[model samples]
Target: MTAAEDVTVVPANEASWDDVAAVFGTTDYPGRCQCQRFKVAGWIWRDSTQEQRTAMLRAQTACGEPGAATSGLVAYVGGEPAGWVAVEPRIAYPKLRGTRVPWTGRSEDKDDDGVWAVTCFAVRKGFRGRGLTYPLARATIGFARERGARALEAYPMITQPGKEITWGELHVGARQVFADAGFEEVGHPTPRRVLMRIELSIVD
Candidate 1:
């Protein structure tokens, strides 16, 4: 397991595109989706080509530009790109507006830009099972708070102890990951999914 001290998190824009791609790899859902699942409208696989999705991710991340806006955070373990977490204003994800998961029992405005969401997490093949998501999840709190978000939310899957979940199903992260990061459960939209959130008090 990589020590927490060996993990470093940075805004996606500050990391190079190569590092981002390294985390996404070329096979798996993360590779094919490229974190554009929520960014695109309609069924992602039907609406966008692989190349188009990749391009969209690149533009959203704005990799290699420190001053540009970024939509996520990248984690480096021992100086190698190991993971990524997609976080940005909830308004940035158009698909969420039409999705039922985030709005089942909640009566909040769907267009709230002050609310941010952690939509996906991807850990590089060689770096899995090392608790990288903990730091990545922890990082989103300050990342969103510092960016002026009123609150940060995540829709994570509920995991069972003996049940084996595919990486594709857990890409949004397991519920405990966000809970450990100080997120409180706000809603349970499905039998297997929970909406967790942390309210942030922005300081001027």
Candidate 2:
């Protein structure tokens, strides 16, 4: 069992791009999608090539440049890259603005830069089921709050006990993970997905 103390979370810009790639290995949907599902303006599978998506991820992460803007956080277990979570201003995800899930029951400004969103989470193969995302999710609260985000939100899929969910389906994260991180459910747009958020007090 991987203890909570074994994990260290850092902004993507502070990590190496190679470490980030290692977390999103080659065989899984994470590798192909490269966390670009909601990043692209159109349908990801049809509009972007794998190479294009990979390039986009690398550029967005700005890995190795601490002074640059980053789109997410990377987690290391015992100094090995083990997980990643994409959190950025909601407007940064053009495709998500068009999706009905976030807009279903709430009247939110689609272009609110103060409102940040946690879009995806990818855990390395060997690190799966170790509860690494809990800390990663918790880290985003401070990461976003310090950066001026008035709120941090996540659209997570609901998971039930004994009902196995594929990694692909849980990439956005399981509802409980965010809930454990102090996020409150603000919207239930679909039967299987709930929008979770934590209203943060922006730091000066």
Give the Å shift of residue 100 in candidate 1: 1.3
lDDT of 2 by residue, 1-204 (tens): 579888899999999999999999988889989999997656555488888889999999999999999999999999999999999999999888778999998889998999999999999999999999899999999999879999989999999999999999999999999999999999999999999988897323
lDDT of 1 by residue, 17-58 (tens): 999999999899899999988877666554888898899999
Where is model 2 poorest over a 10-residue stretch in terms of lDDT? 39-48
TM-score of 2: 0.96
Return the number of clashes found in candidate 2: 0
Candidate 1 regions exceeding 4 Å error are: 202-204
What's every prediction's RMSD, in angstroms?
1.6, 1.6
lDDT of 1 at 151: 93
Deviation in Å, model 2, residue 145 alpha carbon: 0.7
